[model samples]
Target: MKVKELEEHPTFAAVLPPATSEEYDTTGWRAFKPVVDKEKCTGCLICWVYCPEPAIIRTPDRKIEFDYKHCKGCGICEVECPVKAIKMVKEV
Candidate 1:
């Protein structure tokens, strides 16, 4: 099945649900989890800005927290952190 053919099929399109909902939990898809080191963190908020899922948020105390359940573990946080505070570890 070619990609073009699949898109043209009405049966496939009708069977699939709408893509507007945000309630789905995709936590199971992550192969690794990001762990943030509070001591090393400088409150730069770079991780929060680069996060594709926007799972990282600033707390009332200005500390960064992750919404682990919704986080896809894409490592954008780890890569964007200037202080190297966020580390991606195997989900075991």
Candidate 2:
């Protein structure tokens, strides 16, 4: 698939290689989830870099995406975002 098409039609497991985190679905482990505010996001990639689970995905357009299946909702993304673009909201 072309880069543009891949960005538009994101497939979580395809983005990363097989690994420890990828082996299991960790989505249910978090009480909260990080939501990005596009208006405030500068695409600085800070959150993407600091995520321990490496759940953040940086798109070709410089925007950010998430691999929630492996995300633990550790809140590091929200805390590390300099622009405060990421907010951790309670997961319903």
Candidate 3:
């Protein structure tokens, strides 16, 4: 496969040979989870853009959603959110 083409779908693990656990259900080890305050969200997508893992999703209604399955609880989303809509709360 061409390098450019491969880069286009870099996270499509099924088609890629070297897939890691980063793209799987790694939530059990997390100590915290980022909760988005929808009322405060401005939909700027800063959190979505800065996420190292594909855990932050932009919904069709222009809302941000979290997929904890692959989230490592890095808090990058919470930090990047300009409106401070996301808060990292301890997981129970």
Off by over 4 Å in 1: 1-22
For residue 25, model 2's alpha carbon misses the true position, in angstroms, by 0.3
Residue by residue across 1-92, what tens digits does model 3's lDDT show?
A: 89999778758446655766655678986899999999999889988889988788899889899988888899999888888999999999
TM-score of each: 0.73, 0.75, 0.74
lDDT per residue as tens, model 1, 1-92: 99999878676434555654347787998999999999998888878888888788798877899888689989888888999999999998
Most TM-score-accurate candidate? 2
Candidate 2 residues 1-92, lDDT tens each?
78888779747675655565567888899999999998898999989889997899988989998888888999999988999999999998
Q: What is the lDDT of candidate 3?
A: 0.87
For lDDT, candidate 1 versus 2, the one ahead is 2
TM-score of candidate 2 on Cα atoms, chains taken together: 0.75
lDDT of 1: 0.85
The CA lDDT of each predicted structure is 0.85, 0.88, 0.87
Please count the clashing residue pairs in each candidate, in the order shown: 0, 0, 0
Quick one: ranking by lDDT, best first? Answer: 2, 3, 1
